[model samples]
Target: MALRRTAYHYYERRLVATLPAERLPRHVGVIADGHRRFAREMTDGEYRASYEAGMRKLEELIEWCAELGIGAVTAWVLSTENLARPAAELDPYFEVLTDLFHRLPRVAQRLHFTLTVSGSLDLLPPDLALAAKAAADQTDGIAAPTMTVNIALCYGGRQEVVDAARSLVADLVAEGVAPEDLPERIDAEGLARNLYAADLPDTDLVIRTSGESRLSGFLLWQSAFAEFAFVDPYWPAFRKVDLLRALRDFTRRERRFGK
Candidate 1:
């Protein structure tokens, strides 16, 4: 075990040394998947334990990104589609997520990061929504934050596009644009400006854990040109080495951006 630990540390150091800081991604999107599976296999189906572990891993991920000078991270913790699960499953996860939100303000302050919880809040339980709002408020006062962390709760990429479209139309209507002329006023840039976090740069890299190779509607518009790295470890078991390797791989890619 000691020897294995020593080798792991050595490999980690090597990965860090090889990473080109200038080539690192400006914004990273994470699909934090497989918490329940991790719990089932590792914790005898105690999902709360798995959720806690995954949240801790997410915190560690933020620190790692900060250490590497990454500007932003968007983590998809809960999706709109996930609301369809049975209450027995979703309730415990919601409880865990609520606890996470309650505790995140302190972490955000210590890490000097701005936290934004973006999603369809009306669909969530009142307590969860309030907790998320409070956490965001607590972190909003940070002046010149070193990084921006977006916790995507109850988010859906398709729904986000729809919301952006609705927002754009509302603005146009408010401006007294004729309904017939509204189509002309609509454009990609206009819709993009209405997205949840329009100020942040587009995602440069997307990392999905638990061996999932599909995006499943994560950042559909933003990640059009982003590179992808899908790893095998569940979110709770994802190690720093996994992230470092993804970074190294990203640096090596010749991103043509759909040219």
Candidate 2:
């Protein structure tokens, strides 16, 4: 076991050395799937413990991105569809999410990064919604943040687009803009300005684990030209080496952006 561990470290170091800092993606989006499945398989169906382990894995991901000098990261923690899960599963899940939010401000301060909660808060319980808001508000005062980490909860790509459209239309009407000019106001850039995180950059790379080959409505609008890396391990079992391998592979691919 010791020898294998040593060998793994050697390989990880080599992989890291091969990646040029300047060539790395500036924005990374991750779909953190397979937590519930992992809990079922690994913990004998212990939901809370499995979720806790998943949360720890998220911290490791953040650390790795920061070390790699990635300026922005978006993690899909909970989807809008997840809200429909059975209460027994979702109740604990909501608590965990709320706890993570409450803890995020301190994490942001310590890491010198900005935290953006991207999703529809109305779908969440009042406590959870307030926690998400508090985290964002507390982190907003930080000056010159080094990176931005987005936590996507109750988020759906189509829903986000719809919400953006609604917000834009409301703003336009509030300004007494003529209905005849409304069609011109619905451009991509104008719609984007109304998204949850309007200042966020388009995703440069997207990584999804658990052997999943498809994106389940994650970052639909923003990932139009993003490179994707799929790994087989469950979220709880994901390792730093996997992340390094993904980065190495990304450096090898050419992003043509529909060319």
Candidate 3:
């Protein structure tokens, strides 16, 4: 049976209201997938419209956290694998990212949220990198209910680990240390500290849009015990209600810490 929009909305709202703000996760990670697909289904205009709407929804989510007194919100803006997309698709995405690079600071200022991009930034074009830097620098003054919004650009979990390992090995080689003795300093903590968003706290919750249930290698190590809430709505179609559902899911979860 086809579900009516009203009924779906009601269910989403009910899910949100049943969970208290006190049950909100301290750190939330969002995988904004299916944007390109959403754009394909709709016209170009609709695609851009959805992207803008998703961005606004992100603003609302961070505000939700600030209002609920949650700590951090990490968003998956792009993935390492996404860089391999065809040129036609890549062109538009790069444009959107460039626009977002400059626009995020203003958004953050309006919400007083801190801005940052995680992952291997070296993969981005020089101009885009500069814009990302600008956005990050503009938000150093947000004081009340400090919130961090991390955008994962050219980010991958397993790759990050491999890169970190390579770096550690390179440093050891430079120091004339034997390779066999590297484990003493190359522990999990060391590997974590070298990650793109290594400074951010571990994720408490991960939200993936577009009905996808898999992590897609978002935050491999950091989300070791993170709670997950998958949404059927596309990135552009997602709303505050979807975020509320994610929060509510976090509330009902029983985190056992792998006991």
Pairs of colliding residues, candidate 3 = none
What TM value does model 2 have?
0.96
- Name the candidate that leads on lDDT: 1
Writing each residue's lDDT as its tens digit, candidate 2 over 111-198 gives: 8888888888898999999998888889989988888999998999999989899999999999899999998877898888998878
In candidate 3, what are the lDDT values of residues 1-259, reduced to their tens digit?
Answer: 3567778778866775687767778789999887777777775645555566666666666776676667788888778788887776666667677887787777777777788787787888888878887888888776762778888878898987788788777777789888788778677877777777777889999999998899999888889999889999888777777777678768888899799
Give the Cα lDDT of each candidate: 0.94, 0.89, 0.78
State every prediction's TM-score relative to the real structure. 0.97, 0.96, 0.85
State model 1's lDDT.
Answer: 0.94
Name the candidate, 1 or 2, with the larger lDDT value: 1
The worst-scoring run of ten residues by lDDT in candidate 1 lies at: 85-94
Rank by lDDT, highest first: 1, 2, 3
